[model samples]
Target: AQRVTQPEKLLSVFKGAPVELKCNYSYSGSPELFWYVQYSRQRLQLLLRHISRESIKGFTADLNKGETSFHLKKPFAQEEDSAMYYCALSASSGSARQLTFGSGTQLTVLP
Candidate 1:
């Protein structure tokens, strides 16, 4: 079974401070990891992925196979960046592929 873990359930930082949300995974095969964010009263949206090698909303994450981690980082967090973030793992079971989400981490940017 593939699993994703987010150590921090709640994180708080100043508006201009750096923010990081830790994510780690355990899987037997190559896994695709993604960061999903949901703002207050908003639906969850895809933030970034390891395969894309792209950054979104000033947030970026790198997949480290050696450590089995994909941590999301933002140099300067903004008030708008405050949201609930979830680390998800994509795994394949025969012909069906599914996404397993972590418990989630709520990030609050203090003004």
Candidate 2:
């Protein structure tokens, strides 16, 4: 079974400070890591994916296979960046892909 863990349930950082959301996963085969964010009243949306290797909204996450971790980082956190972030893992399951999500970390950017 694949599992995702976000060590911190709540994380806070001051505006313009660096922030990182820790994410760890356990899977047998090759897996894809993703970051999903949900604003106060908005639906959950994809923030970034390991496969993309791109930064979105000043956030970036690198998949570390050696450590089985994919931590989201941002150099300067903005107030608007405050949201609930979830780490997700995707792997092939039979004929389709299965997505497993973490409990999620709520990030609060203090003014």
Judging by lDDT against the true structure, name the best candidate.
2
Kindly list the per-residue Cα lDDT of model 1 for residues 1-111, writing each as its tens digit. Answer: 999999999999999999999999999998889999999999999999888889898999999999999999999999999899999999853344679999999999999
Look at candidate 1 and tell me the lDDT of residue 48: 90
- Give the distance in Å from residue 99's predicted Cα in candidate 1 to where it truly belongs: 0.3
Total backbone collisions for each predicted model:
0, 0
Query: What is the C-alpha lDDT profile of model 2 across 2-94, one tens digit per residue?
Result: 999999999999999999999999999989888999999999999999888999999999999999999999999999999999999998633
- Which window of ten consecutive residues has the lowest lDDT sum in model 1? 90-99
